[model samples]
Target: MSQATCPQCHAPFTPGQRFCPNCGKQISSTGEGVIPTVAASNSSLPPTMAANSNEGLPPTMAAGSNPNLPPVGNSNPNLPPTMAAEDPANHQQPYSQYASGAYTPPPPPSYNGYPGGTPTPNDPYAPPPPPGPGMYSMPPIPPKKKNSLPWIIGAVVVVLVLAVCGGSLYGITQLFSKKSTDNKTQTTTDNNNNGDNSNDTATKSVTLTNLAISYATDQITFTSIEQADQFPDDTYTKTYSYEKKSNFVRIHMKEKQEGGRSAYFSYSSAFSLILPDKTTIKALNAGEFSGPKEGEQRENWVDFETKKPVDLNSLVLRLGTAEEAQMEFPLKSNADLSEYLPKQADLNKAFNYGPMKWTLNTAIQRYDAPGAQAKKGKVFVIVSLTASNPSSSDFWGYDYIRLKSGDTTAAPEYTSDDDDLNDLSAGASNVKGTLIFQVPPSDTYTLVFASGKNLSGTNVTFSIK
Candidate 1:
């Protein structure tokens, strides 16, 4: 009951039948010519057969050689025609289906009639299809992002802040130092100007313009006062101020040459300071004109206007030589001792004294303290003495006193017994005593005494001058 298809008669035949039942054409068992005739029906059969048949085989006889095959030119009756509505002639065409805008998905194309293989060697220009939506893919690579503006801005801000702070600090420091220097300069200028105004009385109401104070000593020898100027008025013009205090004007006269060298003189000249009221303050007398010498002397004159003895707050002095006109006064380095001490003895001693001792403060003894200044030759001294009384008798005796030159506790040029009235009525009365020492301008003097009994107190404390 084998079934087959007739080649020419288009009739069915039993199995092993070698003849066409309808056309009576001989049928060969080789089955080769039968495939060529079937493939001839349409050349597009190759693509269809190539699409579904096994790889690398003749499609016709392979698919149609079945014993229960249908007649030639017959389609599969069981399969719906719409399932493969695509024309088989479209096979072997390049992009024909896609170019037509058809929605049908093309089969996976191959070569050599094999699965997942290359194109046929016979086709020269055959290349694979272009990439599709899902066909082509690449590894995912995320984008890169970078930002540095914030850090850069912050660094700029920091630099600006530091610069501002440093500049501000430096400016403040400079400003303070400048103000201090200006203040000092202004003060010095004001003082010098005031002193200059006080110097010239004729220019009193003239509003003193030149503000320079000059000084010269009497020890220097020069032909003229104008030629003896060491510190010229042109060099230092800065002014100075004076405090409100009593001052006796001190004058130092000296002689020198115009070239700054000291000179010896055979005779001296008279000098004085003329005030605004035509009152003359005599500086040097003709008796003092023996030789070229330098001497410092102070005047105890009271201001005619103030009626108080001038305690030397400021002075305007001038010196004249035999040949030259005059020169401004110069400043001296000597300390003002009048304000410090008010006694003639103390002043003289300060100018001519030595080391001293302190019984109370041992360390202060080695140094000398000028005693005091006296007004109208009156001086005060504070002394201390210690004594013992061993006998029960009240003796009538007095203590001896000495006034020595200089500050040493040595033998003095003047001595006197204590002028105490005798009180001889008790069993040793211990009493404290104080004495006053008056001396002229000898420039050096001190009070001392020998140890004796009946020395009452440990100290003799009182003011002198």
Candidate 2:
């Protein structure tokens, strides 16, 4: 029997043993008489085994052949041809032939110590065992997606922007609505105020009893009022030419000073007459005069002329300032004119009016002058008067004196070469002057002297027969 090494455990074994007692690998006698030659360069076999068989060895233990071992004779003629031996001194096995055998591994035997069958070299056809726990790890769980904080932040920003824009639009709308409402309210209020003012202006009335009379800074009291009317007469037609005929109303008022100051009144543009129909007539002419010194009273007159006859009962007189505190006098025109006309007086007797006295010296009618002819259908009436001012104060001659004949009245004509009776000083006596008047020839006439320019005051009439 030959002693051989167990290729699996490298332990000594008898040649006839079929399996190694140490590693439990199979041992074969078919290797007998086969040279333990190195495998060919292209063959996958162990170097320690012959090329035809690796019967006693495991695949991992096969390396180089040991030439010191004695060669055994061949006992099987059917074996494949062996590699020729080389000289022992220089012999080398190729590194590629080491552990390069094509041997099939056997199935592993059961083992009580391990959980499953142990793998062997000859078990190439066996399926791999299932992997034990913890041997493989699941693919690293993809890290959970981090919370989408950026997306959340972007959404919040968009929402805030929309909210801000919407709020601004809403605020603007409210502001405009409020402004429009305010404007409408103001307009309504203004209209109401205007309506009220109009109502107030339309209903107010002023009257003579309640006439506002003021002098300087003090209010004055009205003492008496006198008025008269003058119609066109034959003398007026013969002496004066007019495109439009008119009637004259003379208004006179005596105002007493209530305060301790002399009051002066001016009649320029300060008079207007409101007719029954509410038509207003401005003064045709005005005159100015001063009232008596404090507590004394004097009369002044204002004249107005109109083409249409006025209803004196409904007439309203406005005097003084054109603005505030205008004096209003409502008059009655039913007074008899004969009561105010003077009675006929002799030419030699003196006639007295206020502080002045007058005497009619002569009356004559002439149709021609020294160098000028009298106007056709007209005659000149020349009257000589002697006036005396007995009062201490100067007397202003009445410029409104006239001559009346039937329905005619004639104003004095100053065109004659006669001295005018204007200002007369105190204590003056026998101031003689001639007053000339043009009139139509008449059978009867009266020489009249008025106190003031409107012919409203005392009148002295001298009958010329």
Kindly give the stretch of ten consecutive residues in candidate 2 with the minimal lDDT sum: 198-207
lDDT of each: 0.34, 0.51
Give residue 130's lDDT in candidate 1 (0 to 100).
Answer: 42
Model 1, residue 453: what's the lDDT?
60
Best by TM-score: 2
- lDDT per residue for candidate 1 within 117-202, as digits (tens), equals 23434556777534444555465787876779999999999999999999999999999997996676455445544655334322
Please provide, for model 2 over 1-465, each residue's C-alpha lDDT reduced to its tens digit, 9 standing for 90 to 100.
344665654555555445554445776545432134332323455533434333466422332243432243433232212212222223223212322543233333423212332334566765564444446534667878878999999999999999999999999999999799667645543543344322221111111233334433223333223222342332332222254555555454555555354545445455687766877777654334443455665555555654544533456765445442344555533323232121232467467766778787777655422222235555566677888888888866556568876677888775543454677789999888877777765666677766564324544444444
Off by over 4 Å in 1: 1-68, 74-145, 194-465
Query: What are the TM-scores, per candidate, against the unseen true structure?
Result: 0.21, 0.24
Model 2, total clashes: 14
